[model samples]
Target: MFSLPIIALLVAGAQAAVLTLQSPRFTVSSSTGSQLRSEPISLAHASSIPVTLTKDDVLKLTFQVIDKESGKGVQPHQTFLRFYDQNSGEEGIQPIRVTNGGKAKFELNMARPPLSLPPTSDAPLQVSLLIGSSTYSPLALSLFDLIVPASHPVPAHPDEASFHPLPEIHHTFRPEQKLPPRPISALACIAVLAPWIVLLGLWGQVAPRAVHLFSPGIFPFILTLGAFESLLVWYWVDLKLGQVLSYGGVLALVTIFTGKQALSKIGDRRVGRK
Candidate 1:
């Protein structure tokens, strides 16, 4: 009787050992959007996937993980869902937690904030999925992006072709227009020194100074020269270097103009610096 009990204990221990050796390895199955995987999934296989979506549409994904040997389900602590754009290389990811016997599901809404939809339709949007690994398995999806074109909502048909609405007729220039030949830097330089040059040129004619202010066309000459010079400076400072040179230019111009006014007044005794 004692021997029989020992044999029963040995059999139980062996069964427990088998179960311990049989824990699951993860596999991925996906039903994403309208696309479905048609072949056995493997690390080496390449998958061609497609999705269909309309602007402001929402989508859901259902997938599973399973044990390779016993056909039991498996779930991971953390899994990531990703959206990829094939053309522009844009992508987004959301984390999903698996529960209730290794089943995972994800829902994503398709909407654009700075919406670009149509009138236009069938724009290509490709997608790819990444699970836990850095490399995505051979599964991906694609879609067509539809955006409202600029021509949409045709401006309220003018009361008459010649009614000529002022608002419509007026051109809206891009804020980036005139772009300073570079940007704010060049524009700032022109703003700062321009007044000084103009005032100095005018003062040269009226003051008790020997400096030729405008004779020989120096005023216009210098003005034109500075304009071009500053353009190059603007490009160099703002465009090439990506630094704004205008702030320093403004401060220096203020100092120079004020100082000149003070000095001129002291020299000519005119209004204590004119």
Candidate 2:
């Protein structure tokens, strides 16, 4: 009778030992205009999952974790959920304490703050559920891997041109408008070349007398010039005034330091002569 009880306990312990956990399926709830939409998602088809959310849209995801062998919901205390962005490297962990039929829900606010760029549509994010003890065996269920969509879709209009036709123009007999003068201003050209001319003059004047001074300044000058060129390109192409001003401020500091060093070297040469 004692051996039979011990064998029964061993069998019960073997049944409780977890080998793997089932991947959770998700249901997403989103609102489009005045209508609310709910869609089911399978973890097995995570690679093809489409994330369709616009700015200021609210998104909700719900899923449940279960044991692979028993096909039963895993206990809340034995599981935890982790959400992370693969591109931004931002991660958040939540304890799994589901009160409703072993289902856990996560909510996300998709509103973009003022002056902030929207999240990249191509960037991937993941939600995973981990199970089992930290010291021994553990299993991870990749609940969802989805790419966020950045922009809202434009509705197609089949006869838009027909509805909004171009207006007719009338030609007036008047004197020909005077065209602007050809070629850029000479002052503008001088302003552009002035920095380069100054740098070249300083190099010529200081390099022969104090080779050490010139060599040390060369690397910084080149670096500053490179940064300035990059800023110039950014200004012309992107037309971002804030970046241009910030970079110009940094370049100004570097140029001031270079000028001070050059002046000091010239003073040293004068002192030696005297």
Candidate 3:
């Protein structure tokens, strides 16, 4: 069997350990640099009284991350402080950077609160600590409840378009076109068919005396002309213009060669008779 990679084995070992916070503490101070309340955070339960911060007040937090199996401090991959409001269901997460020795400190000033701080209200915000490391199980501990001033009203949504009555729609359309009567349409059809009808009617009279017309050289020329006429009729009925044009071009070449041959044969026969 293949063995796991060294990095994978190392991560597995780390995950088997247990992670915990040591010396977790917080201090509330005034803007004039006087401490208001200072105490070590309890890991077992939340404090009876809620921590409150007015405008311009500051809150400082300090802690050390360590593996429970080994008392030595250890830095974890992720360390965050979460503030949540149960009533509004709004929460914010602020990342805290830990040193190589696992010591961490965070400062939250109400005058310049971090953007991660969510909109607040009269309700107390639940504060908690979250720690995660590749070498150990993740740890989360509820720290305390906090109260802050009510936030301003939420502004209008930037992506929403203005809603108002729109101007009445005025549509302009082309007038209906009138078509010709059936008798006129039939007359037009006759106008197109008259030449074909007259020529076909005269073909029988001309064919009997035209001995050269059915000959090999002239017959091909006549057939090519018929192909061109058929292609025109096919285009008018079903064939596309491009297809008819392609077939016509090829037929034109054949017609040119055949017509030249037929005319040359006629000229030779005339010379011989002379």
Candidate 4:
């Protein structure tokens, strides 16, 4: 049978989706600089991209701007970024002005939306940029439509300690570049997951409080997930298993709360059930 943690993870994870956004490329000439040098910048790197994060997940958005003229970095005067809910027609996420090395580095952290309250599914959020008081329109709206459906739970404040990294994006960006290889011995994984699996099983046998299982404490959950990923990193194995297991653990908690009602449906089929 699948462990409770694994089940919980899968249940929440299955709701996640990939989101991407691209801005438009523009050439800002001094109108009469030296040698008339031109710089190259990608629309993909300049705009705020939509990201789905579960509570306590930390997200960092990096934008690199290169100057072609002096073969150096180009810094803009002031960079303003905004996050808007396309569905609600309201601004959702906002950040203070970003200055990269005293210039427009074009990179900023996409702070997660406030979650002191509940999240509404009515609106889809998007990021935007303001350079020198001019609103630079993004390329095609279709370009920046990355939407990871399941995000980490929002915290009272936006800080790294309260964030979890996204494994899917990590894998996508570094293709075929497995941080760690598969464990030579499955025993190691079994050993690691044993305790939680047992707890999950026991919970299944004696179901617990529903609220305790699904409470809004995404930080601890994400921290635990990060620890699992860190273990995989140390073991020199791909973290895919850990990622799935992370969510699986959560799902298991959910199952335990539901009196194992979903067990019968999941009994015969599980992604990596043993």
TM-score of each: 0.29, 0.35, 0.52, 0.27
lDDT of 4: 0.43
Q: On residues 1-274, what C-alpha lDDT tens digit does candidate 4 reach at each position?
A: 5569887767655543212222223222222332222233345453343344433333334443333233343344434455555664545433323344323323221244443212344345555554432222122222133232434444545566448673454334645655454674576788888899889999999987654334334334544556556655754664476765766677557545443444433453455462
User: Which candidate number maximizes lDDT?
Assistant: 3
Off by over 4 Å in 4: 1-50, 66-68, 92-97, 100-120, 133-143, 146-274
Candidate 2 lDDT over 105-218, as tens digits, reads 656546642222223445665766666653224656675664455444334497765688767889978988986554556667788889998899999888666345346645
- Where is model 2 poorest over a 10-residue stretch in terms of lDDT? 112-121
Query: Candidate 1 lDDT, tens digit per residue, 190-250?
Result: 8988999989998989877646455442344445446556756777765643233564465
Ranking by TM-score: 3, 2, 1, 4
Number of colliding residue pairs in each model: 8, 0, 3, 42
Q: Candidate 3, residues 90-148: lDDT per residue as tens digits?
A: 89999998998899999999999898888888889999999987767888889999898
**Global lDDT of each candidate:** 0.45, 0.59, 0.87, 0.43
lDDT of 3: 0.87
Question: Alpha carbon lDDT of residue 187, candidate 3?
Answer: 98
| CA error at residue 148 for candidate 1, angstroms | 12
Candidate of highest TM-score: 3
Instruction: Give the Å shift of residue 141 in candidate 4.
Output: 10
Query: In terms of lDDT, which candidate is stronger, 1 or 3?
Result: 3
Evaluate model 2: give its lDDT: 0.59
Model 1 lDDT on a 0 to 1 scale: 0.45
